[model samples]
Target: MFGIGTYPRGGRLFVAALAVACCGFGNTGTADADTFIPLPGGIITRELADGTTITIRIDEESAKVSPSLGSTPVHRNVWVSGVGSVDLAGPSADTATIKISPGYVVGCQMDISSLGVNENAGESNTLSQTAPYITPSLSESFGGGITLAPGQAVARLMLDLEKPDDYGMESHKRYNKVPGPHASVTWVDEAFEVNGCGGYAQARSFVLAEIDTTTFIGNLALWGQPFTMG
Candidate 1:
């Protein structure tokens, strides 16, 4: 993975900027500080096994990091937003279904910079590779907040769509599904909290997309730059 406006076939790119806010209540250092990171989202173009071309783009993504309202060393807060888009070309493009899953990977005292679209970040075991492609697990959830210890990491999805199931029971989904040659999912100012980490913490954004067409099914992922939580 790379950073910011870089497109290297199957690689990733991200760019970030940080702004520090003035402290209040006589607090010093990074305590009570707020940081705004502007991220340059990425784009990926891939050709499926049946000669279908798919493009996925992560755009208008950013995060605002600040001290948690608890004001404790073990608590952190962030607000994130992004847009995930998909476009398809070639055969079966008109009848394809796209599923978009946008989420964040939070690590406690561990460097998650090496986590790529093809590798599972120590959280799930369902990631499998099919020659030049990977199938990502889509069973992540956002259960209020995250708690992590040193050397531990978690993947929290940003969306939870509540709808009626086949039997009229409530069903929750972590991804948005759409049809055809183009689709998009947009999230704005979604806030999440992390706690129980006594060391430095970091988080990165990702968009996992699955394209199901008449001829073949494929998966694509785009990643953002990692930013500090404290």
Candidate 2:
């Protein structure tokens, strides 16, 4: 999934994010002695040394977040797209429990461009392509930077998802991006199956969302984490 915007361009830009899942991602929103913990798995509990239990969501499969942790785990039953959920704190103390369910497979969305590009009428530069990766894959360089001129622009944005090989090596590329500049365009790739050969495929999805910028004067920001499948 990607969201695009335009502004004066100068330097190259890129953005990335990991899939959101089990106690996946969270922020305290403050710097005081607090931790921003994400609970996406629908049911999560942090046991204190003194036996005080802190319970919360597992975060990967749902978007419905409570303002704060509730007392009854059942009340935290939030809704999610594509994933069936489990009950909270059901009668077990030592049994680490998990259940299987059906859900959509989300891929990585890279938006590395931000604030449009500003060309110097006669100057041309190449827009570089970021590398693609498989699960636990590293980033790469694919598209060369685009050349630009004053008052003229190019859509240097592209999102690619390649399926891994039979042995789990990636072998396909699914790229989505508007070829040119438009006001604001959002391209969301449909959910696809993950490379299942990896042991963690049933529980994790690696995602990267980046901002591509010509100049680094301003900041490009991305919110949210990877979509959890467990």
Candidate 3:
């Protein structure tokens, strides 16, 4: 349940967070104001257990908030990509094991590409399929966007969980404040696995992202929520 609308006000959020941490531009940046927010990308398809066809696609999630020296505002870093594919609708070809249930990637090295998949690449979100979720479902990859259909595409994964951490809002005593791109890539459990036929199958899907810190600092914003299970 995520399909709101409003991410283009005039000039794509008005970048000002010290040029998004340009390289060293942050001695407490923030001259006056110009919040920048833009988030929208989603898609999730499911049908695994032998007749594989599990597709998940997230184009680009976003976030930016600059101006930090003490007041509170500096969570710049954004660039996310997704594309999970599997289609063995019976008859022949098989062998599938897509895994990326991993939390968040803030730098690099979360890549996977398969032209003729025989995969085992970058595996580590640790969730091993356990099927059993026809009701207690929940979706919120920020809260909107998912459309991927056409034989269910194939493998592709990219990450840029930008890093800036240190957004002082102090909700209470946790301090995480949704920093570090947070983390939420679900498949209920197992995320992926399909080898020969059947006997044990369970691989649903779900994603949730956040980064819209706008209370008054530089205006930065980006809410490309994501969530889906089928």
Highest lDDT model number: 1
Which lDDT tens digits does candidate 2 get at residues 53-99? Answer: 22322233323222114332111112222222222122221222211
All candidates' TM-scores?
A: 0.75, 0.24, 0.23
Off by over 4 Å in 2: 1-127, 131-183, 202-223
RMSD of each: 10.3, 22.5, 22.4
lDDT of 3 at 45: 39
TM-score of 3: 0.23
Error of 1 at 39 (Å): 0.8
TM-score of structure candidate 2: 0.24
Which prediction has the highest TM-score against the true structure? 1
In candidate 3 the C-alpha lDDT for residue 46 amounts to 35
Error of 3 at 220 (Å): 31
How many pairs of residues collide in model 2?
65
* Residue clash pairs of candidate 1: 3-14, 4-13, 4-14
